[model samples]
Target chain A: MNADQLADVVAGVSDPEIDVGLRDLGVLRSVSLTDGRIRVHLTPTRLSCPAVGEIARRVRAALAEAAPGHGIEVVWERGAWQPAAVTAAGRDALRRGGYRVAGTAPRCPYCDSEDVEQAGRFGGAVCKVPYDCRGCGSTFDVIGTAGCNAMLPTPVRGGSR
Target chain B: MPHIPTDSDVYEVFAQSGHGTALSHVGSIVSPRPDAAWHLAKETYGRRDDLVKLWVVRRTDMIVSSAGDRDLLAAKTRMPYRQPGFPTARRRDRSAAPPAVAAPPERRDSGLTERRDDAREPRLTDLWLALADDLFVLGNRLGERIVDYIDLEEALAVGSIGQEALAHAGTILVLCGFDQPAVDARFFDRAQAQWQVSRVVERLTDWPSLVAGGLVIAAAVAVLAERTAEAEPGAEWLSAISAIRDEQLVHLDHWRRWARALAAWPETRTEFARAYAEVTECAGDMFGARPQSQGQGVPAAAPPAGPALAVTLHERLAVLVGDNGGPGSRLPDGPRTRTWGVGGSALADSLSRGRAIRDHYAPGVFS
Candidate 1:
């Protein structure tokens, strides 16, 4: 497949747990064709994240669905993981869907209220901390550091040279 | 139609305590609909003491580790030292004691202490003991009551009582820290009823006398069964009591088995008898003290050659003993006495009354 097609195919790997596109949680850093195989560089929200396996499997599945018989391998790196740095493209989609984009103060994902309070360290997911929007009176979880908690980053693997 | 989340769907539940605090894993919950899932999450995870807020997320959306490496965080080695075996155990004792004591002093001992590694063994043992004793006593009572009677109603009543007692005993055993998932229904079918009776037994402080009386009757029946085999060989009446004794023995053995749980829950003693009584009532109308009008009014005379005399004698004895308000009857020209004592003046009156009943019935048969 062409590099552009592969990029889109790679981008299709969403966060395995949230079902949100990888481009949204910002883990899809880059997609390039090095040698014969396609390489996708990926980072999770945390290094010791629990959902890394699931994320990797979903990525493989997405790739296979896009291009049947496509060989995929996932290499997860702990560094370059930041919940705040979700990509612009991904951020726009998440924002359009009424989810607060990563980075900046996490406004209540539910009400988009900046006037929020920390409800608890634990949220709906392992890495997400629940926050209450003072303005909207709703509670939502902010994805916390990955590899550190249950939340893992978007799935990506290096191309076979 | 709202979609119900299958087990595969994972929801990220977030609990908020107050403001700006981090949420921790209180627990996990499963459900179908997002809204319904949220409620289920709250019930299962939030019902516990730790949780205040809950979040539900479909599992499909969440990222997770592979099944192969799920135990990476699991403690592989003994970390006793991390909790209590530190080298500075002495030094920390001085510095940490006051603050540890100060932080939620009420909770320090009652809550955290319960979770500590040290207290669990003793606490579990205490619970086990209480459960065992409670079941054991109840089992003894049940075994003594089980009897197969000639009359269908009486047999059914006895069977129900036995079943209820065993049920209570079995559950008590299971709950006494035994990890069994289910109880043998044959052993204790009417446990709820037995528990009610147990409550009453606990309240009646004079229960020892009643229990002792029951035990004595059981023993006497056992003796009579043994004698039946030896004397008047193959007498059906004696065999009947023997069969009843066998059932009673089984009940006793089962109780012996479950005594551990009974000992664990001492507080339950007060309520068990009352529960048992309620259960018994549900099983059937109790055979409790029926007015003389209701019981078999001295069954009609049997043929002369039949062993009716002995049966009539016993029935008469039972009626006479039952009459005079349980052993305090004034016999003509005889000394007044309590009825239960062996060979007491009351016994003489009972014997005479029984003989009179036999003669009176025998003439009717002849006539």
Candidate 2:
């Protein structure tokens, strides 16, 4: 299989917790075929992310099925993964799944109201923070900046805070 | 009347979703007491269906390293040996396996020869060993009293911190060229006098004493780790020391929080103050001046000077207890002259107690 086809296969693997494809989540760092060996690099949302092993396993299994008898190496790159890495598609997928992406002014997922206050800096998972909506009287988790200060609202990219 | 501030501190909450999952920082809450912090954390972060366990630590207790410290975290050279995926990657690419361990610098011989005239001077290896052994002893010491804490949450926190200390000690041992067996031997078989743990760690008698002594020693270790990293640039162990220092900062914060909490209440304040004074009395040598640099010949870096470490510790203690004739008013204004080193009996006793417990449960498994 060509590099593009292999990339497509690997990208199809979704994060088990969020139910979003690795490509959309911007975790699939890169895919390249050099000397007939396919190399795929993944960057985790957090260094201590529990889903990393599962994600890597799924990527490996998918790639192996797509490109039979080919050398597949999945490398985990070490660095901080930012909320800005999330693709627009990833954001939409998360919103549809009742989650809001951080790095933007978080709105209530249920009512889409801007009147939201931080209930907790932490949420159900490491990458999420809980926000309470005044309009809907409901609490929703935002896929916030991993391992960064969740207390402050992350300024939107290329925009004033 | 003493002005007791009513404002609560922010406590960061970490939670484990399942039995085997790693605890992740889920969020934070504002609370006055550790118990109240835990309850607020549960309400805030534990609304989820997956929550299994929780740990609430004061946010201010965290010692965050500055941006300049990032260089210490960065790998100046590629260290494929440390990476878990390196072997598989090497096999897939038909490349050779990287060396399992990097050789530590040969500063010991030079350090000794240069300081031959000054027989009292410790070699760089000796200082490093002292730091590691101290942590090992402190960690096991904390483990012995985990069940003796006032509450289950405090016990759990103490247990977690103890495990962290032990882990940090193990990392330092690896940097000192110890393989797994050597590391195990160092923990289980080292003779008592050979241990270089500070006297403060050996003197922990109760919960208040542990909190006070741990605060002092954790701060000292953080200072020593920073000084060691600064002294030995480009060394293979720099990264390990950096990581240890980072965690040591957290441990320092944890202890500081407990000290402040205990001191805030009128009932516990006196007890904590007495414990702090006792620990501080023997903790003098921990911040002793750097052995006067053996003139010109020593190639090894001098261990961190005592005054610099003492200044920082005094400042932290002053903050914990107000400077206005508060609990720590009796804190020494300058580094004390007395030398500090626990006798081998302290370590021997600790080991015997640990062994007794092990033997009680498993019946000679440790034997």
**Model number with the top TM-score:** 2
List ranges where model 2 is wrong by over 4 Å.
A1-161, B1-120, B145-156, B287-346, B353-367
lDDT of 1 by residue, B98-141 (tens): 32111111211211111112212222122222222233344343
Q: Please report how far candidate 1 places residue B8 from its true position, in Å.
A: 46
What is the per-residue lDDT of model 2 for residues A3-90, given as tens digits with 9 covering 90 to 100?
8888888879999998899888878878999997989988766433557768888988988787777787877653335577888898
TM for every model, in the order presented, reads 0.27, 0.46
Tens digits of lDDT, candidate 1, A32-69 = 66555556767656432457667777777777777666
Scored by TM against the true chain B, the candidates give 0.22, 0.54
The reply for model 1, stretches above 4 Å from the true place, is A68-70, A92-102, A146-161, B1-367
How much is the lDDT of residue B37 in candidate 2? 84
Per-model chain A TM: 0.72, 0.87
C-alpha root-mean-square deviation, each candidate: 35.4, 23.5
Candidate 1 residue A144 Cα shift, in angstroms, is 3.5
Worst 10 residues of 1 chain B by lDDT: B285-294
